[model samples]
Target: MKILVVDDEPDVKDLFEQRFRREVRNGEFELAFANSGEEAITYLSSRPSEVVLILSDINMPGMSGFELLRHIRTDFNAPPPPVVMMITAYGDPESQQQAAKLGANDFLTKPLDFTVLKEKLRTIA
Candidate 1:
């Protein structure tokens, strides 16, 4: 599995690398990082068709995850990646519903619990 992680914080990317290092080491998964939604989209758009999942932060400078979700839904009219999960510190009901409406596969709260997230990914993977 290839998981494209989109977060503005460099530290968050480092933490994710730390957390998922074993998976990468074992060759079970590969991870990529994008600092913003636009960069994420650009990276994915130009990729060699290998991304299976997207883990995105909600609030971003250029494009929010909600808008990114909308963009994927609209732009990927045919076959698209089936897994796109939103991660946010601000997890309100309204935002959750909005994310769901925008076609997010899952919404995860910040200070993430990797155990649970892994279980969810198992279902998708």
Candidate 2:
């Protein structure tokens, strides 16, 4: 699976790589990182069909993940992946509800448990 992870934090790429090392090595997953939502959009625009899933953080500088989700739901001419999971440090009910309303396939809170995330990814895969 080719997964795109969008976050503002610089270290996120390394974190995901470390957490999903075995899956990456075994060819079960291919991870891509975008430092911002704009970058993610650019990546997707060029290769819309490549990404199988998107894991995006809700809080970002220019384009919030919620906005990104909305864009993906509405703008893409090609059918992008239906699975977009929103991740955030804020796990409030309102946040969760908003994500669902915007068509998120799932919601995850930060300080992420990769074990649970891996299971979810497996189900999707």
Candidate 3:
């Protein structure tokens, strides 16, 4: 499976790599990174069909995750649209509800629980 991770934090790539080392080594999944929503959108536009999942941070310098979610839902509505999971540091109910309403497949709080994330990925796969 191919997954795209969108976050402004530079260390997120390393963290995800460390957390999913086994999966990466075993070729169970391929990971891609984008530092902002604009970057993520550009990447998706080029290869929308390649990614099966997107994990995006809600707060960023530009083009917040919610906007990205809306873009994906509006422009990429092809059958089996890529599954999107939104991550935010602020675990507010309103943001969670908005994300769901915007078409996020899952909403996750920051300081992620990788075990739960893995379970969700398993179900999707």
Candidate 4:
């Protein structure tokens, strides 16, 4: 399971890599990263076969994760694995509903609880 993490924060990428490094099955899951939606799109376009999951932050500068999610579902058609999850500081009910309607598989709140996120991730993968 190759995973692409799209976020603006470098720490987020580092932390994720650190947390999951021990669990990954000898590179079965390679973690790639992109700082913005445009960069993520570029990576995806170039190596569509290398990505199996996406962990994206909902708020970003240019194209938000929601926008990215919409693009994937609408443009990528039936071939994509779907977004693994989205993280956001704003846990509004409306936002959650919108994410679901837009096809987000799951979500995590900001100040993320890694234990819970890991369990959820395990359940999926």
Question: Each prediction's Cα lDDT score?
Answer: 0.84, 0.91, 0.93, 0.80
Which segments of candidate 4 are over 4 A away from where they belong?
A: none
The TM-score leader among the candidates is 3
Error of 2 at 22 (Å): 1.0
3 or 4, greater by TM-score: 3
TM-score of each: 0.92, 0.95, 0.97, 0.88
Rank by TM-score, highest first: 3, 2, 1, 4
The regions of model 3 sitting more than 4 angstroms off are none
Off by over 4 Å in 2: none
Q: How do the residues 1-125 of candidate 3 rate in per-residue lDDT, one tens digit apiece?
A: 99999999999999999999999999988999999999998998898688999999999998999999999899875778899999999999999999999989899998999999998998998
lDDT for model 3, on a 0 to 1 scale? 0.93
- Candidate 3 local Cα displacement, residue 52, angstroms: 0.5
Tens-place lDDT digits, model 1, residues 1-125: 88889998889888888888887898877889999989887887787357888899999888988887887777643475447899999989999999998888889999899989878776777
Clashing pairs in 1: none
